[model samples]
Structures are given as C-alpha cells and as structure tokens.
Target: MIATPVSSPAYLEYGLDTLFGRITKRAECRIGLEQVENDAFCFAIRVPSPLSDDLEQAKTLVLRVEGRRLQGTVRHSERLEDDSLRLEVEPD
Candidate 1:
C-alpha cells in the first residue's frame, strides 16, 4: 500500500535516516510500509539509487508504525523495476 509518511517537526520522524546511532537526511524520499510473513515489516524506499550496506540497509532499523516504534533488520533489498528499492525487513 502507498502511504505518505507522517509529518513531524522532528527530522528523525520524517527525513532523518538513523544508522549506527547516527542520523542523516539528504534528499527526501518516501517509503511504503507493509507487513510480511513472520511478523516482519516490509519497508519500501521508492528511490532510483541502488540499495547498499552503506545506507544502513544491512543493519537494523527502527520503524515508527501505528504510533509505535518497531525494530527490524533488512534481510534483503532489491532495485525494483520501477527504480524503487524494496527492503524485506524482519522485525526483531
């Protein structure tokens, strides 16, 4: 499902990218959140850039969903046909 991320004055809630305890935000990007099998979370980053371990794709991510924060690890990420990045995350 397509979703607009919840807007917040805090960059961490919107533009901030948390990785290795560091927060970074460059160009703004949107992602669709979905639930996968085994309580995993599918976070889709719709960008043309390829997914890499440098962008924290290989590490755990904290996702804010339904007013709660969930910890997840990106199991795999692939460049979609539409140039988007699909990350299969398993909640931990």
Candidate 2:
C-alpha cells in the first residue's frame, strides 16, 4: 500500500549547532509519512539551506504532528539540486 502525506501541519524541533554549544530551535514545515512496517513509520521533510545546515548537525529531533510530539533520530539527509534539504527520520 502507498502511504500519503499527513494533512495536519508538522513542526521540527531540533538543536542548532553553534560555536559555543547547541541551541534549541523549531520550524514549521510539511512532512510526508510512510509506514515501513507494522507500528513503524518514517517522516520526510524538505527544508531550506539555513535550516538544512542545522539539521545536518542534529543528532535527534522532535516532530509535532497533530499536537502529538514524537522524538526521532536523523536517519538520513540530502541536499537537493535547489539547495534545499530532504530528511528522513525514524522515531524511537
């Protein structure tokens, strides 16, 4: 079966790496949800350069979907041709 994107708005909360340390930050973005197996899901988001840079250094993240917060690790990320970033997250 094909999975569809969630209709509700999604927000990404992650730590931004800085010279001193990491700072918490959040961004509103759209995400696509796919079920890899029973009770397992994958989240995908596309973000701009600035946010992408932060995500590259992020080890874990919090995703708010429909008011429910899910914590996950940054499983994979890639830079698109337009300089935006695409990320895939697997929730613990």
- Taken over the whole model, the C-alpha lDDT of each candidate is 0.46, 0.65
Instruction: Write model 2 residue lDDT over 1-92, tens digit each, in one string.
Output: 24445444678888666788868877786654455444447765556554444666676788777656777777777788967676677877
Candidate 1 lDDT score at position 20: 55
User: Which residue pairs clash within candidate 1?
Assistant: none
TM-scores for every predicted model: 0.48, 0.59
> Per-residue lDDT for 1-92 in model 1, tens only?
34434331111122223545645333333345554545434544333344333443444455554454545566776766765565566656
Where is model 2 more than 4 Å wrong at Cα?
A: 1-8, 35-43, 46-53, 81-84
Clashing pairs in 2: none
